[model samples]
Target: MPDPARLFQSLSDPVRLRLLRLLVREELHVQELVAITGLSQPRVSKHLGLLRKQGWVDQRKEGTRSWYRARSGDDAPGGTALLPTVLTLAEELPQTDGDDERLVLALGARQAQAKAFFSAMADRWETIRLRYAQPEFDLGLMGGLAQPEARVLDVGTGGGALLPEFAATGARVLAVDLSLPMLVRARKRCRGQAAGEVDFCCGAAEALPLGDGACDVVQCAMVLHHVARPARVVAELARVLRPDGRLAVTSFCAHHQEWMRSELAHQWLGFERTEMERFFRLAHVTPGRWLQRGPRSPDGSGNGNGPNAADWPEVFLMTGIKDADHGG
Candidate 1:
């Protein structure tokens, strides 16, 4: 818990307050904060160091990159009204509106970088993916989610992993991806799989290119790690799913491999299963089933890249159902 007087004092600086306002909305890298605030790197670091010490901000470092966000809810400072009060007053500050605008650009830059990376790697994405594991077995595990003649939406269906499996189910499958090259590859790969139709759409996961309640089953295989905002993508999945529709997701478990961010264009280094559950709950999707493939050490550390394949981290499958009560 943060001391009451110090916590309040932390918000006393207009400069520090501005950083909090941006962080409360989105987690930002240190360089991004410098750019957004138009401040020197040392100044931004100074302010962040203070907020961090006061327990109003949280920080994470991956390799050389560092990300910071305002600590909120149970992790935030004790006073419930502190952030709300700070944010309300901060909005009137001259820098608030510019911070919002710069934040959008920063986030957009992230998505654009991901798009470029996937587009470039489309031809050999499968080769890169195999380094993790053969994902077909993982996809096949969720095959039962598709019913005959049901509408299935496969987000991030890179190289058509989920398409061929679902094609035999007699379900109408829709494959979506932001990379045109990836979609082209997926279409060609699944063309002769004996499926009648598999529609391919070029779209990002954060804002799926589909109408509300448009799907009976939505599955995203190994995709959450690639997107800039995984939680928002889950909400978008719920938006396209009809009430009681099934949602299946597969991805690598949390790992320490920072190299994946540069080599594989992974925005996140996988996620904890608990984080996936929280995403489902926030999206009004009820988690139903869980499975894991691959291996993990006793300490829950994913120490892959070692000589033995046994050192690899596990890939997990999680299934959820869109709730009827969700307004989506």
Candidate 2:
């Protein structure tokens, strides 16, 4: 193993410094480092090699590419403090924040009673197993992310589908869910993984029992629409993200899916792009993108190349920076 002290020294180079900063938020490969730090591939590789020798980082192979991440344990080359310090410093930069509300109240009651409902619906979970496990929505939400060796947090993780793919990227994954049964299922799904590679915690999204700003990317997919108080969930998601960290939340836009409308058995609001903007404003989170299928045509037919009905009701995939002003 490389010495942590020496590893810290190797990370002192400017390009290495920027690379480490970016990786502290999300794992990136050499090409990504090259793109972000404006360094040549050889220089990036050299720094990474030196850093690896010092035990500051670790790499795992996926297909033809290798992704690097901060290693855990005392042997970690970055030493105990280096990566944390770099992450803290990065958080001082400008950040963003995001929210929604009253249907939330009703959702809370349903969530509280989720055990019974989901238990009865467990069989159905298997039907949607592929859907939940490999949600196409995640492709859009995680589009810009997916770093090698990243540590990702999946909040309100149902059926634990997102966990495996994140793990497949060789990133450490932590999944939290409010429903006990859901957590049980998630744990079962990740059984026998390498230690620290995957973890499941039972907790509500509003009161996560995690260290502040610990995850590089915190994602909540398809869960916000089910929360009784989604604004509070937004605040919590923002709270757990490091200032430079990314939060991508995927939920139903107020209108799109006929199934979701029927599932909720209400005239559930689909987001007007503007209304969605307001939701983010309430939580002090700046919206990054409004990913949608092409605009809908008259008579509700989506414009060609727009997202289909199955991709909906429309998915409100939004990303934001964690506001530093609202300290967790």
- Best candidate, TM-score-wise? 1
TM-score on alpha carbons, each prediction: 0.88, 0.54
Give stretches of model 1 more than 4 Å off: 61-64, 73-75, 78-80, 134-142, 295-312
Model 2's alpha-carbon lDDT is 0.61
RMSD of 2: 20.1
Please give, for residues 199-233, the per-residue lDDT of candidate 2 as tens digits: 88888887888777777788887676555456667
lDDT of 2 at 161: 64
lDDT of 2 at 134: 33
**Per-residue lDDT for 222 in model 1?**
83
What's the C-alpha lDDT at position 150 in model 1? 87
Which 10 consecutive residues of model 1 have the lowest summed lDDT?
A: 295-304
